[model samples]
Structures are given as structure tokens and as C-alpha cells.
Target: MKKALTFLGTMVLTLAIGVTIGQVSQADTPSAPGSADDPIVTKSYVDQKLAGVGSGGNTGGAPTGGSTTDASFKVVTLNPGQTLKGGEGAEFILRGGTATAIASTNGGVSDVTGADDLAQGANVELNHLLLTPRNDGRGLKVGSSTAYVLVRGSYTVQ
Candidate 1:
């Protein structure tokens, strides 16, 4: 009798858990412009993979990998002994921000040429760095002098 009772109790507990899970699943749901039935995981799950967006600023379970994360990228042509540089304190900024990187240049490093190189709409110039003092573009001070380029920044998309 005790064994039978134990079996019955275990069965009841399992049934209760199963029913709870079912209820919870039906309790709430998220939706996009449509209903939950037409779910659309329109968030970025791949970085540097290219498409309509970047990690989209949302991991969506995807983390940033490396320089070529969201999309395959080509490097700026550099001579054997050539080097590129940024201003003493030049930061990188993608027009419209990293989210818009898909339709535009996503994350950017200071030294390289404009965001997407010299492609159409490309605003950065990662090649041939000018090391003038006074922070000209994106490079160290050529020497210890004082000058300025005073140019606005831009991003590029391809």
C-alpha cells in the first residue's frame, strides 16, 4: 500500500508541474507589429555578418566577435613601412551610431581611413596619416608644433 501511495504521489507531482508549465507558456507572450502567432525575431543575432543592421546594439544572444564581426571588411591599402594614425584624441563615431552600421559604416577605429574606406558615402580615410601637431585628422603629431585641420567627421557604407 505504501509503494502504491508513493507512486500515486509522484505521478500527481509530475502532472502538476506539466500543467504549470503549460499555463505559464500561455500566460504571456511578446509580439511585433503583428500578433504572437506571427512571431518575428527581427533582432540582430549576428555581428559583422552584414544585412540590415549590426549587433543592432542588442546582443540578441550574439556578442561582438572581432574587427570583422558584423560584415566581411577589406583593409585600407598600406605600404610595407606605412602607418596610419589618429589625432592625439580622435574618437570614432558612426553616423547614426552603431545601429545604422548596416546601411552605413558600423563600429570604427580612429586610425583607419573613413568609416568604410573610400567607398561611396565613405567619409573616413584610413590610408596615409598626417602626423601634424594640433590634431589634424587621425594621427599622432608629426612633430611638436601647433596646427589644425578642423574637419567634420563622417561614416561610410558599402
Candidate 2:
């Protein structure tokens, strides 16, 4: 009878110790950064980072009213004869008006949406996502009217 009681007490003690260890390990485990349990930064910090983007030059276009989670596209208006030069990896989508591709000696703009390459003087397709492969003056030249374009990444108007 004594051995049975001792065995029961040992089992209870082991169970209690196992539970305590489990709880301790869970408490010590840190939540992943940028997760729901632990955010990487505050809302203000994210806002400040967003504000710094597209600060220089003519940022006259508003964000496209779409279901995008972030403001990645900047709408830009270009006058006739003006060129929208893109830096490396710059993305462009001609929203309105007419424009032509301005290719450098290296190559031309990549029309990802159309799955084609636009050489210099090629007409830019409206609503197509164009990507500049290099920073060597590859972009779009506005036609004889005001052109509206959605630009993402580094670019300049000249």
C-alpha cells in the first residue's frame, strides 16, 4: 500500500513538473517580428517612411484609386515634348494620352503586360506595365497632349 501511494505521488510530481516546464518554455519563446503578436514598428514610423518616398521633383499625381494595400504607384502628368525618364528598375503604366518609348543604346523598355520589348520611338501601350531595365535614359516621351502615367520607383521628368 505504501509503495502504491509513493508511486502515485511520484507520477503527480512528474506531471506537475512537466506542465511547469512547458509553460516556462512557451513564455520564453519570443513572437516573430512584424507578426500580429509583435509588430516591427509603430504606425507613425511606417507613415514617415512612406512620406519620404517620391519626395523630390514633380510628384503631382494622386494615388490610383484601386484595391492596393500600399501607395506604390505615383500618378504623373507630362506635357507635350516632355520625357519621363526612368531609373533602373523603374515601372511605368501610361494611364492617359499618348507616349513613345525612349530607349538607350543598351536596349528599350520592357512591356511586361504586353510581353514585348519597346524600342526607341515605339508607342507605349496604355495600361501596360512597362519596366526600365537600366538607368540609361530609358523612359517615355509624351505626345502632343498631356499624358498621365503611373510611375513606380525612381524617375525624372525632362
Candidate 3:
């Protein structure tokens, strides 16, 4: 009886050790870096800037980072086909060449301010939002005053 018990204890220890080693090795291993075929490494800006409307004291600096949780932004010009969600303090910037404005949230209704820009060949800045996901209002629009809305800017994505 003692011999059988000894054998069983040894087997359990061996299994435990094996499982530990296997898990450790599996975690340490890395996937083969993909090349041309396997798949290589994968890899916003605000629409408007509100000037001094003459407010009292300065507001909290939280909105600048975007949503408290990890968020992303989709940017497109001449068409409203993007969504904007921000990280903590995620600020977005874009260059729409003057007539670059987006209509977000409200669809084609056009209710938000800074959604339409009359500026051309220039850059516009929009302050990040606090609630309601991101700072996008309806869809950005490119007026007839301009031909193409060139885009340039950065937003946190995680």
C-alpha cells in the first residue's frame, strides 16, 4: 500500500511540474513575425476652435484627453464617414483647407457648432468632449467654396 501511495505522489508532482513548465514556455514564445505574406506589423483632430466667448474661470482640463476609457477616432474629408472616441485628454486636430467641417452625432440634421468651417487652406482645432463618447457632431462638411478637404492630425487609440 505504501509503495502505491509513493508512486501516486510522485506522479502528481511530475504532472504539476510539467504543467508549470509548459505554461511558462508557452507564454515566453512569440508568434513568427509576419513578412510580406503572413501579415506585417499592423499599425483627428477637432473641427473647430471656440475663441473667447468671455467666460468666468477656467474649466476642468479633463475633456482635452477624450474619454476616460480607451477610445478611437475615424477621420474622413468631404464625407461624413468617421467616428471619434478619445482617450483621457486625447486632443484631435485636422487641416481641411478651409471648407472642412464634420456633422457628427445628429447625422445630416446639422445641430452642432463648429461642424461647418468657412476657412480654406487652413487648420481648425476643436476641443475634446467630456461626455457622449467624443467631440464629433453630425458629419463634417466641405462647402462648395473649396474643392478638396486635405486632412492632417493625431488622436489616441487604444
Go through the candidates in order and give each one's C-alpha lDDT: 0.34, 0.90, 0.39
The C-alpha RMSD of each candidate to the native structure, in angstroms, is 18.0, 11.5, 21.4
Lowest summed lDDT across 10 adjacent residues in model 1 is found at: 95-104
In angstroms, the error of model 3 at 113 is 56
Candidate 2 Cα misplacement greater than 4 A, ranges: 1-71
Sorted on lDDT, best first, the list reads 2, 3, 1
**Judged by lDDT against the true structure, how good is candidate 2?**
0.90
Poorest stretch of ten by lDDT in candidate 2:
62-71
Better of 1 and 3 by lDDT: 3
Q: Number of clashing residue pairs in every model?
A: 19, 0, 26
What would the C-alpha RMSD of candidate 3 be, to one decimal place? Answer: 21.4
Best by lDDT: 2
Arranged by TM-score, best first: 2, 3, 1
Residue ranges of candidate 3 with Cα displaced over 4 Å? 35-39, 43-158
Estimate the TM-score for candidate 1. 0.19
